[model samples]
Target chain A: MKPVATIEGRAIPLGLKNLDTDVIIPAHWLKTITRDGLGKGAFETLRAEPGNILDDPEYAGAPILIAGDNFGCGSSREHAAWALADLGIAAVIAPSFSDIFSGNAFKNGILTVALPQEAVDRLLEVARDHPVTVDLDSQTVTTPFQDRFAFAIDPFRKHCLSEGLDEIGLTLASSAAIGAFERMEGRPWLVPSASPANVGLNGTIA
Target chain B: MASRPRTLYEKIWDAHVVERREDGTCLLYIDRHLVHEVTSPQAFEGLRVAGRRVRRPELTLAVPDHNVPTTARLGADGTPLPIADPESAAQLAALTRNTAEFGIPYIPATAPAQGIVHVVGPEQGFSLPGATVVCGDSHTAAHGGIGALAFGIGTSEVEHVLATQTLLLAGSKTMEVRVEGDLGPGITAKDLILHIIGRIGTAGGTGHVIEYRGRVFEEMSVEGRLTVCNMSIEGGARAGLIAPDETVFAWLEGRPMAPAGEAWDAALAWWRTLATDPGARFDKSVVIDAAEVEPTVTWGTSPEDVAGIGGHVPDPDSFADPAKQAAAAKSLAYMGLAPGTPLSDIPVENVFIGSCTNSRIEDLRAAAAVLDGRTKAPGVKWAIAVPGSGLVKRQAEAEGLDRIFTAAGFEWREPGCSACLAMNPDKVPAGERCASTSNRNFVGRQGPGARTHLMSPAMAAAAAVTGRLTDVRALMAS
Candidate 1:
C-alpha cells in the first residue's frame, strides 16, 4: 500500500444514507475464501435496477465515491471495503461512516473523508457530472467549479494513509519494544514457545 | 484530585496502549481475538499470502456459526457434517483449514464448545473483565457484558490482530448511559435497549464507547446484559461495555478460561478497580426510566424504528428530522406496513427465537415460560428455537426447554446463528413477516424482501402462538 495524497477522477454519486455492508456486498457472495473479483457482486441488489451509476459506462474506473450519512452501516465484513477498492474507488467522501468500515478502508489504503452534511450535499451534486479532487495533504475536496470543501480524518489515520503503514507494518515499527517484552515474558501468550512445526506422527523428526 | 477521574473505557484503553503515535492514534493491545466463519476467510488468506502465523495462537479462537444450518443432522465419522448448503459448507471448511494451518484453536460444529461466537466466548469465560476483545462478527459487542471493552472488527483488522496480536486504533469518546429504577416485570434488557435506541436514534452512540451504568443493568443477569450490549452496534456505537461486578465475576468463576485460585483473587481485585471513578466525565449522558419501557418491537426496517407493542406505527411525515422521515418512509414501504397500524395487528408467518442477541439459556427459559402449555397458531407457518451454541443446546435439552418448544409446535434445533441472516436455509420467505428475537430489522436482513420485527424471545413466542405481534405484557396481565 503506497501513500495516497490525492484522488482526482469521476465520482460515482451514490448519496444513499444507511447504505449497509449487506448492500455493499450481499451475504450470498461472501462464500468465496478470496477477496478477488468481488466488485461484480458489489451493490448486486441495487445494480439489478436499470440506470444505476455502478454500471454506468461514464463512471467506469472512477476513483472516487460520494456517499451519504451512515455509509456502511451493517456487518463488520471487510468485503465491503474490498469491493469498493476493486471498483477502483480510491476515496470516499461521506458525512459519516460506520467505525468498523472506516478502519477496514484505512487498512486497505482507501481514504475515508468525513465532511459536514452541507459539504457532502454539495459534493453529491458536483459528483453527478464534473470531476472531483480529494487532496489528503490539504484535507479538502475540490470540484471543477472551484467548490472547495475542507474535510477531516483522524490525524493518525492520515499518517497511516500517507505512510502506507498497515497494522503489521506499524507493529513491526516497534520491534525493539516487542523484543524487549518477549524477553521479559511480561505476557504469557506472547512467549515464543516451540510449536514443533514439520514433525511427524511417530513423535520424532522425520 | 486535580486530574479528572477516567471512565472505565479510558481506564481499559490506557492500560492496553502498546505504543502511542504522534498523530493522536495508538497501537492498542487486544487480549482475545474471536473469529467466525463468514468474515475470517479473507483474513486467513491474507496471512497465508504473507507467510504469517498468528502472533499468539493461544489468544485467538475460531468457530463456525453464521452459515451452519439449525436443521443439520448428525452424521457418521468421515461423512460430511450434514450441511447440504454448499456455500455454508465451503465457509466452514475454510475456517477449519485456516485454524489448522495457523495453529489457532477452533470449535467445530460437533464440538461441545461450538455455538455463536459471542455466546461461546462468554460461556467459555474467554471474555473477562477489563480486557480488550475483538471479533470479526458485529455481535462481538456481546462480550462486553462480561465487562471487557469488546467490539467487532473488519477482516483487515482481524488479519492485523492475527499477525501482530494488536491493532492501531484511534481513541473513542466516552458516553455514559445510566438507566435508573427497576424494570417492570416482563420488561427484559431487550426492551430497555430498544427504548434507549428509540430515544437516542440509531446514530446516537456514534464515535463513542457507551458504558452501561445504573441500577437496571446492575440487576440484570449476564445473559440479559449481553442481550442489551449485543445491539449497541445497531444503535451505531462502535463499542459498549459494563463495569465488571460481583455478578460478572461469579459467572466467570470456574469457567474454562478464567484465572484460577490465587490468580482469580488477584484478577478480581484488579477488575473491581476498573469501574468508572467517582466524578468521571462523559462526553454525553442519558437517563432512561425503566418504567416507561414496555415490550418493544420494531415496526420498520431500522432497529431504531421501534415502538411499544401497544403503540401505533408512526407516520413518517410526522418526523422532525428529514433523514429519519425519508428512512422511515422507505422502511414502511419495504416492510409492507402502513402508518398508524396498531403494532399488535401485524401478523407473523414465522417466529425465530434465536440470535446472539437473545439466544442464551435465559432467553429460551423466558420463551418456554410463555409457550409452556400453548401451541402455535394455525397461521404460523413455522416457529423455531435455535440455541446459541452446542453447549447451550445441551443445557436446554437437559432442562427440557427444547421439549417445551417442540411440544408447542416449534422446531428445536442445533446451535448456530440460525435465521438471523439468510446465509443458511432458515429464512423468512419473500413477502412474509417474521417476529424475531435477533437484532436488526433492516430490509431483507433475514432474506430477500423478508420483513423482520425485532422483539424479545417471549414476544416472539407470543407471536408464534397468536400469529400476530401480540403484547407479551398484555399476556402477562391476563
Candidate 2:
C-alpha cells in the first residue's frame, strides 16, 4: 500500500463514458500465464488510432487518467486494472465506475475517484499535461490551478482501503464475532454437525 | 396465532436470512459461491486486505474462462501463430495466485473441470436444491435448475459472501411464467425464451423473481431449463428459477461435489421436499402456449424486439404504443433493415456460437447438426463454434462434433468466452452483421456499428452457410 494518502501526478485525458474493460485490454492478449507484460496491451485500441491518449507524446508518463462517466462497465476482467497499473496510472478520475471494476482497481493499489460529471469534464479539459492531486483522507481531488472536487466512497470500502484489508482481512478481523455467532441458538444450521473436520461444526473446531 | 402457507420462494428466502433490517430487506446467507477468472481477482484482493480466510473455502469453487484464447495459433493473416496474448495471461495469473492464496479450489485452463462457471457448477453438483448460491457472473441464475436461489453479485459482495457467507438483498415480488403444451420439432429452448421476451417487453419483469412452470418447462432437460433461466436478466428479472424434480436429482448424481452413498440418499430425499407446494401463490402470473411458439430471432437491439423465422419484420407504424414504435423505428434505422422484409432475408457476414449464455455441449450439437456436410457462404469472413468449458470441449470432440463443424468450414476452438462481445480478436469487423447464439444484442455488442442478430446455435449455423438469416427448419427439411 502507498504510504501517502495523496498522489500528485500528470493526467491523461480520455473523455468517453462506458469505456469497458475490453477496450482497456482486448481478450486476445489473455493467453499468457503472467501479469508482468499486461502494460503493453493496455489501451491497445486507443493506441491504434492516431493521436490517441496513450500514444500522444505530450502526455508521456501521465500517472493519472481523467475519464468520462461509467468507465469500466463490462465484464469483471481484473486485467483491465492490472494493465492500467502497469501502465503507470496511479489514479483514475471518472464520473462513476462499474462496481466490479472499481473493486478490482482498488485491490491492485490504484485509486478510483468518482466525481460529478461536470468535475470530470473540467478535469478532462485540464488533465492533459497538468498535474492532479488526489487525497484519500480528505476524499478530494485537486488540480494545481485551484480546482478541488470532493467525492464519497462507501464507508466499508474506505475502511478497507485505509487499512489495506481485503476479504481475508475482513474475515480475520471478525473471527471472534463469527465464533460467537456460531455458538448461538442457530449453531446446528450455521455449522455442519456431520463434517467433523470443518470448523464451526458440532463440538469440533478442527 | 395463524400462519399462512409460504411459497417455495418465501420459504427459501426465510431459511437463508441471518438478519433483517428496518427496510424489510434480509441479510441472506450465501450457501455456495462460484468464481471465474474474470471476476475473482478483486474479490480475493479484498479478502487479502481484510486479512481474512475464506469463511467457507469448501463452499466456493473457481474456474478459468472468459479471457482464455480460443484458436491454437493463427495470426491476423491466418498463418500458424503462437497463442500468447498478454492481457488474458495476466488475468489468468492473478486468478491462479489469488485462489492459491485463499485456499480456494479452482479448475484452471484446459482442466477437465474448467469451463464456464455456470456450466461447471451444475455438472459438479455444487449447485443443489434449496441452497442460496452467489457468483460474480449474472448467469449464476442457471443454478436454479436445482430449485436454488442463485444470483449474481458484485465483487465487493463476492468479498462479502466470502467473509460472511451472507448477502444483503432487497426483497423482490414473485412472478410465475407458465407455458404448457408441446414445442414443434424445429423449435428449441432458445426459441421459447425469445418468444417469452417478445410477449413481455424487456423491462416487463423488472424488480421481480420469475418462476418458470407448466408442461413445457417440465419436459425440458436440465440444460434446457438452464438456457431459459440464463437470459432472465435480459428481460429485467432479478432471477428465473424452476422447481426441482427427478431430472434434477439424476443430473446431480455421481458428480464430483455431490454426496455419496447414504449421504446421497438423504440429500435426494431432502431435495424432493424443496419443490413448490400445489397451492403456493405468486404476486403475478402469465400463461403462454408452447404450441404457438416458433423458432424466434431478435431483429433489433433488445431481446424483446424479435420475430419468427419466416415472419416479416414488424412495421414500426403498426405498434400502437408510441414508445415501442419509436424504439422499433430507431432499431430498424440503425440496423439498416426495411420494414416488412422477411427475417430470413437479412444477410449475415459471420456466425458465432459461444458465451456463458449458450455455449453448452447441447448447443454445440445443435450447430453441428445443422452444419453437417454443408459448406459455408463463400464470402463469409468467419464461422466459429466455442464450447463453454474444457469438459464440454472434450465431450464434443469425443462425439466427433468437432469434425462436423470443421468439415462444414467452421472453426472448432478451445472453450472460452469468445466473440460474445468484441473483447477478443474474434470480433466481427465494424459495420458487419452477424448471426450469434450469445444472449445480448445491444448496440455495437459485437463491435462498433456491428449488427447482431441473436438466434439459436443451429439458426446461427444455418445463417453461416446461407450467408443470410435462413430458416433452420428449411435446411433441416432439405
Candidate 3:
C-alpha cells in the first residue's frame, strides 16, 4: 500500500452510475495470480469504445476520477481497487459507493470521497478542462475554478490511507486480544477438528 | 439493569468485539473463513511473503470452484483430468499448494463436496448460527440465511483474517425489510428478491445490514432464504439476515460438519437467542406486500431494470432522470432489445439454470418439475443445469432430476459455478441472449458481449422449452 496525502492532476470524468466490478476488470483478467499489470485491463469494456474518456489522451494517467452514484456496486473483488491504483488513480469522487468497494479501496490506499451529486456533477464539468486537487489531510476535493467540496470518510480509514498502514500488521498486533476472546467464548464447536482423512471424498489427484 | 434493545446484527457485533478503538472501529473476531481459488491465491502469497502462518487454520476451508471446469473432472481410469486453460489450471494449483502450505483444510477439485464456496459453507455446517463468516466472494452473504453474520471481503481482508483471525471494522446500520402476506403461486423466493431489488434500487441497502422480516421470509424454506439472501450484495447490502429458526436448525442438524449430541443441544440453546429483541429499532425500514411481487425478470443490464414477466421493455424516455435514461438506453443497445417489446416475446438462445443464487437441490428440482416432459425449443441451442455442490448433485441424481433435465434436452453437468461468470469453459456466445437463473444481469457477466436476463430456475426452464422468456406459471398451466 502507498501513502495518499494530496493528489493533484486531471480527472477521468466517468460519471456513469452503477459501474460494477465486472466492468472494472472482467472475470477473464482475474486468472492471474499476481496483482500487477491489471491497469491494462482496467475498465476494459468502457475503454473498448472509441473516444471513451478512459482512453482519451487528455485524462491518461489521471490521479483522480469523478464518477456518478453507486460506483463499484457489485462484487467484492479488490481487483477493482488494484486496477484503479495501477491506473494511477489515487482518489475517486462519487455521490455514493458500495460498502465492500469502499473498504477494498481504503485497503489499497485509494481514497473514496462521497460528495453530493451536484458536487460530483460540477467536478465532472471542471475536470474536462482543468486539473483537480484531492487533499486527504483536509478531507476536501478542490478544483481550479474555486469549487471545493467536503466529503465524509471513516476517520480510521482516513488515518490508514494517509499513513499507508499495513492493516494485516495492525490486526496481528491485537492477536493477544483475539486469543483472549477465543478463550472467553469457550465454544468448542466453532473450531472444526482438523482431519486429514477428509481431504477428498474420492481421493483422486489431478 | 436493562440494556438497550439490540438488533440481531448488534448482538453479533457486540459478542465478537475483542477491542474497541476510540474512533469506534473494533477488532472483530471472525468464526469461519471460506476461501476460493480466484481470491485466495494473492492473500496466501502475501502470507508466504510475510512469513505469516494461518492463525486458525482449522477455522478456514478452501475449495476451488470459480475457475474449475464444470465438465468431467475424472477420466475413464478414475484419474483427475487436467484443466485445459493454463491460467485457470495455474490458479487452481496455487490454491492447492497454498492451502497445503498454510495448513488449511482443503477440499480438492475432484472431491465430492467441492462446490461453490458459499454453497459448501452451509452444506457442511461450517456456517452456523450466531457465527461471523467471511469469504473472498461476494455471494458469501448467502450463508447469512443460517443466522451467520457473513459478508464478502477483498484479498487484503482475506489475508488479515487468515493471519489474525479478526477484522478491523466499523458497525453497520440495521435495515428491516418486512414482506407480509402470502406470495402468489409461481412466485418463488427468487422472484421476491428480484422484486425487492427492483423496488429498492441497487443502492437502497448500501451502508446497512438488512434483516428480512415478516411472514413471507419466515415461511420460506432454508434453501429459499439462501437464495434471497444471496442477492443482498446485488442490492448493495454486504449481508442480509433472516432470523434463525426451527427451519434453519432442521436443515443444519444432520449435516456432516454440524455438532451432534450434547454439543448440538448447547448450540441450539444459544442459537435460539440470536434473534432481534422486541422493540429494537432499525435505522431504516421497508415494508412490502408479498402479493405485489410477481414472477420477475430483468429487462436490461442492471438488476434494477426488472419488470413482471408480463411487462414490456421500458422506453428510456420513461425514466425521469437523464442518467437513468441514458443507462437504460445503453443497456437496451447492449442487450439488443427494443423499447415496448414484451419481455415474454424476447427470444433466448441459451438457458443457464445454476449459480450460487439458484443452484441448490431445491432449485434443481424446481427446474426439473418445469421440464418434466417438455423438450427444449428447437431455436434454443444450449441449456445446462449445474448443481451447487457434489452433494446437491448426488441428491438430485438420486431423485432422478438429472434424468428429467436430460430428457428435456438440457445437459446435466457437474457441480461448479459453470457459465455463471464464464470463468471456465462454460460461456454463452457473444451476441447471444441467455435466460439465466444466476444473480447478475450485468453486461458480459456470462461472457464477453453476452446478454443475461436474470430469473428463477423454473423460469429458465420455461425459457428453454419456449425459446423465449415465458412465465413459469403460464408453462405450468399449459
- Over the true interface, candidate 1 deviates by an RMSD, in Å, of 6.5
Give lDDT tens digits, candidate 3, residues B303-372: 9999999999999999998999999999999999999999989999999999999999999999999999
Error of 2 at B261 (Å): 2.0
Q: Chain A structural similarity (TM-score) per candidate?
A: 0.84, 0.81, 0.92
Ranking by lDDT: 3, 1, 2
Tens-place lDDT digits, model 1, residues B113-219: 67898998888767778878999988788888888889999888888889888888888988888898889888888888988999877778888889999988888
lDDT by residue (tens digit), candidate 2, B1-478: 1156666677678767666656575667677788877666766776676576787777787776666677663457856454376666677778878777887766766454567788877766667777777787766767876687877665667777788777656677888899988899989989988888788765566657788888887888887888898877665566788888888878777765666676677666666665667787899888889999878899886778888897988899999866567767877876889999998888888889988778888898889899988889986788888888777888999999999999988888877777886655677777788899987776666776678899988899889889999889989998
Give each prediction's DockQ, rounded to 2 decimals.
0.34, 0.09, 0.54
lDDT, candidate 2, at B195: 89
Please tell me which model should have the higher lDDT, number 1 or number 3: 3
lDDT of 3 by residue, A11-90 (tens): 99889999999999888989989988899999998989998989899987899998888999888889899999899888
TM-score of each: 0.95, 0.74, 0.98
Q: Residue B462 in model 3: shift from native, Å?
A: 0.7
Q: Please provide the root mean square deviation of candidate 2 (C-alpha atoms, Å).
A: 7.9
- Full ranking by DockQ: 3, 1, 2
| Of candidates 2 and 1, the better by DockQ | 1
Give model 2's docking category: incorrect
